[model samples]
Target: MSDKFPDQARVVIIGGGAIGCATAYHLAKHGCKDVIIVERNKLTSGSTWHAAGAYAQFRTDPNAGRMMAYGGELYAQLEAETGQATGWNQTGGMRVACTPERRREYERAITIARSFGVEMALISPQEAGEIVPIMTTD
Candidate 1:
């Protein structure tokens, strides 16, 4: 980045966190110029810095799930498009449900996720434990 800020900008974003940076990136990706991002601190130094950097492609609402699915796809291709590493990994995620009610809820989410082409599944506690050996199934 240059030290000199432009006198005028077509769009000025308020933060330098993930959302703000993503908005600017997408805008520029779509051929929009003259964009500026103003940050109170260093980039990702606020809430975004504390984030777990995990994304789930399933939600109670199918629309929200679809957006998450979009994010997963975008992260997968961001490095290739920008020639910059986003540190995104495609490791599969798991949600453990020790109770029957939570299990039902996840089943519902799986249905919603799958409805919009997001692949999610419910596995036995044993299966989940197998993936993470230190986790207890019982």
Candidate 2:
């Protein structure tokens, strides 16, 4: 919880996103103390903090998928170790697109999610509303 930066570090991570924080955690856990995270913007300013605060184990690469999966698996231990709330949950996610190109992107996303063993489907905007009441197809 120290906001003051150190003079130097052996490893410098560019972002304070989940992945960067996790890397710092493991590195510190393994007895590496000279690690620093440099976030150009404020902490949690990236997709990891925004984007509905969703956690996904699905990724285009198998290794990436496994790493995401590992993050969930490690969450309990992380919270226990740091005595902090991870804010982790299983609420799932939703994406809405008004343009044809955006819809096509979602279509492609579905395929990628499926390939990564994620259970997702293309649902109507009303159906999406069932998941996130504030969401709209319009």
lDDT of 1 at 114: 85
C-alpha lDDT values of all predictions: 0.87, 0.74
Estimated TM-score for each candidate: 0.90, 0.58
For residues 48-128, what per-residue lDDT tens digits would candidate 2 score against the true structure?
A: 757666666545455676666566678747677778897756656565678889778767766766675567677887887
Runs with alpha carbons beyond 4 Å of true place in candidate 2: 1-4, 59-61, 92-138
Q: What's model 1's overall lDDT?
A: 0.87
Model 2: per-residue Cα lDDT at residue 50: 75
Per residue, candidate 1 scores C-alpha lDDT tens digits across 1-138 of 789978889999999998999899899989997899999999888988887786677689877888888888999999998899889998877877778898899989988888887878888778878889999888
